[model samples]
Target: MPELPEVETIARGLAPVLRGRRVEAVWGSGLPLHLNRPVDLRALRAVAVGRTIRRVHRRGKYLLIEVEEAGAGIVVHLGMTGRLRVQPAEAPRAPHTHVVFTLDGGGELRFADARRFGWVAAGTPLAALAVLAALGPDPLSDLDAPRLRDLLAASRAPVKAFLLDQRRVAGLGNIYVAEALFRARIHPATPARRAASRAPALLDAIRAVLEGGIARRGTTLRDYVDADGNSGDNARALLVYGRQGGPCRRCGALIRRRVDGGRATFFCPKCQRR
Candidate 1:
């Protein structure tokens, strides 16, 4: 999944080109997105085709594009293998290029998802607001240990599971969760309430890893690219996400991996004590 950093990279890269541009023409393959077949594509075309984009905002893993002319917004979710790009109108279209928005200035904005996991919804302002309303807090906020404790004080789920829940803390997926937990030296299976005391270090690790990911563009294991179609470079700087059986960066102990909640959870067994 393209989490906070990856989505943020796309939003930032797209803001300059998308803002103030009017959608001159809209084209899309006749395929159902989000499995919400029978979706009124006409509504999207009618409301968005002529409207000018006023802003590009990000909410968790979603991108919100405000169309001021129509008093509406377009919401985009880059599920798994999705990529949004800005290119010349005459540029060659790649496979699975599902949606193309032709701008009045001869530029083209495209939404291409190799696996059809991504979706774009065009509607009134609520299109963006509904998405923003569903997510929790970002790690970059002033979410200190005590506050974090109040949030997870009731859950007995593993700490990693708590972090993965968007309702608990939005914009985190498997890769960053594993890395953050390892950095905080809290075992993934530790009960959430029991791990509350470590919230200060945990929050600090979350901010550091997420910020570092944004600085590096994002961590690209596969099929992730920014708006300019560039892969992330942060994979090289990862501490433990995919390093099962490898030496820990901080300790000589070998890294380990286990299946937790059907996801691969990696850690330095000796460094991340329960």
Candidate 2:
């Protein structure tokens, strides 16, 4: 799944290309991929046609495209494995490109998903979207850290699991949580409140790790790519995200891997001693 950084990167890239450009039309596969309505590519065209894109924004992992003709927005969620690509309207369409929006500027924004887990829904306002309604504040914004600290302090879940809970801290996923825990020298298996005295530093670590990811475009461990079809460089700079048996960058201890909430977690056992 595209986490905060990857989604944010995509939103930023799409903003300039989409802003001020009108949606000329839309097309998509007729079958709904999941329990949701199969995107009637026609409905997309009807709602968006001639509506100029005002801005692109992100909340949690959801992408929002604001339209100018009405007080409305389109929400997109890139599930487990999905990709967004922008190509020339003349480019040959690729398989798995389920949704294509023809832009007024003669370009097409495509949504491709082999697993078909992603979704798109239109709404009157971004806030009324179901996903946005439940999502916590964005981590990139002025986060309520003291509130987060209180929340985590009350949970007995493993630190990593607690971080993965969107209600506690928005925008953290398995990848960044592992990286942040390693950066804070805290073990993924540690209880959330075990390091209460260092809560502030731990919070800072989370922010730093994600900010670093955004700065580097994001960590593309697998299929993630920006709108222009570019892979992220952060994966190359990762300290321990996918380095299961590699030496820890800071302590030289062998990086260890384990499963938490069915996700791989990498950490330095020695350095992250609880």
Candidate lDDT scores, in order, read 0.85, 0.81
User: Over the stretch 1-274, how does candidate 1's per-residue lDDT look in tens digits?
Assistant: 5888899999999999899999988888877667655335676787688789899978778887888855477788888888899999889997888888899989999998888878887757644455566777867774667778877687889999999988788888898998899889999999999998888888989988889999999888988989998999889988999999899999889999999878999999998888
TM-score, predicted candidate 2 vs. hidden true structure: 0.92
- Give the Å error, residue 37, model 1: 4.2
Regions of model 1 farther than 4 Å from truth: 36-39, 69-71, 127-131
Please give the TM-score that candidate 1 achieves against the real structure.
0.93
List model 2 lDDT by residue over 160-258, tens digit each. Answer: 888888877778888888888888888888888775556777878888888888999988878888878888888987888889889889988898888
Best by lDDT: 1
**Angstrom error at residue 257, model 2:** 0.9
* Error of model 2, residue 212, in angstroms: 1.2
